[model samples]
Target: MPSQSLAYAVLFGHVAFIVVGALMTVLSQNLVRALVGLIMTLFGVAGLFFLMSAPFIGLMQILIYVGAVSILIFFAIMLTQSWSSGDEAQGPSRKRAVLASLTALAPALFLGLTIIFKSPPSLLVAEETEVSALGRFLLEPYILPFELISLLLTVAMAGAVILGFERRKQR
Candidate 1:
């Protein structure tokens, strides 16, 4: 009933929403449902970042994940034909999905136990340092990577055009 408890409750809700949304996205067979779950997860993560005092990161999360990444994915999905040949290729493979779920769980469980047992030093206090640190790294140590990504994007665009426009030789 107290203010602190209310804050904790809200934070827990965000965390729960994020976890559920992420799992739904991963598990869903339908593309549109997965996209919806991904969007929910993105917004939930943005809320978490905001609570962690990185408002800039929250904004970037929304812009990069929801605005750009999702749109790019949606465009690719749109370009594909919706025809399902007999049994749909888009349907989930139960065995592969189970195997993948188990594989992911192993690492997650291990990392969780390690953190619990090792008891890493807690900051107990975190402030908004993400933007400055991210900016410095982007302009400094990661400048080459940034330039390489740009070059890669250019190459990919050219490749897409070549694939899209190429005509097969007629016999």
Candidate 2:
């Protein structure tokens, strides 16, 4: 078993990543910077999952969010003509920024309060969930939501392709 100090250090690091990344995600003017921040946030979440003894979830967090989703966002931004390197300096209006800040803070505050006030649940032992069990759960009982998400991604990709082609044709 790891020492208490070491575990605390790791937890602190993960929380730092989560807080900084989340701030960057919402605060950055640049879209790519925001995307990078989002990836950082996801990476932090993966770290937390690993700490909780959920390696499968951590792997999925890194693979799906940091890898695929980030790449997709990068590609989408690259393919767009509206957003360029120069435009990164230009930020949204003050009203919009305040609203966005409030939007992000509200949920975070609620979560913090909930954690503070809630009593711990009683359990005999913390069960370790296997990746195979998760796979079965996704494919069996939650198949509809899973399939719907896949379909949504497919449609988004198709739309992006069509939009890219149209933009190229016009240029």
Candidate 3:
């Protein structure tokens, strides 16, 4: 258990950053600022992971998320054809988009709140230390899902390559 003072600081600080980061992600006009906000959001999520007693997950989130996803987003920006001046207004979306997003968000928020309030506190399952344990599970029990994830990664990489090549070829 954490010291009361320490826990309070961590929890409140994490929550504050999460809210501010979410606002930054949504409300920033500049794309780069939005990306920075996304990075902050990821960092705040990683902090929450640590608070939940999974330091390993927190480290992995920082390493895989901030390290890879942020760079990928920047690369995607550079690979695009449009380089507009910052002065142009990002006009509001059409009515259909507004309606569609709200339609999705309303149920999502409701379900999220319900789950948060209804769930029992979680207990930590014991950790197994043997490397062979994972191998046995992965190859025997979880083979289908494992291969599915691999296949998805392959398709995603191929799509990224095709799009990237097309952008450069047209330029």
Q: Estimate each model's TM-score.
A: 0.75, 0.72, 0.72
Highest-scoring model, lDDT = 2
Candidate 1 lDDT? 0.82
Worst 10 residues of 2 by lDDT: 80-89
Candidate 3 has a TM-score of 0.72
lDDT of 2: 0.84
| Cα-based lDDT at residue 94, candidate 3 | 79
The RMSD (Cα, Å) of candidate 1 is 3.4
Show the colliding residue pairs in model 1: none
Rate residue 168 of model 1 by lDDT. Answer: 92
Local distance difference test, candidate 3: 0.78
C-alpha lDDT (0 to 100) for residue 40 of candidate 3:
92
Q: Where does model 2 exceed 4 Å of error?
A: 81-86, 122-126, 139-171
Write model 1 residue lDDT over 1-171, tens digit each, in one string: 597687788799999999999987776666667778889999999998888788998999999999999998877666673323323346767898789889999989999999889997876336768577888989999999999999998999999899989899899
In candidate 2, what are the lDDT values of residues 1-171, reduced to their tens digit?
468678878999999999999989877878788888898899999999888888888998899888898998888778773353656667679898788879978998999899878958755334789889989999999999999999998999999788768744454
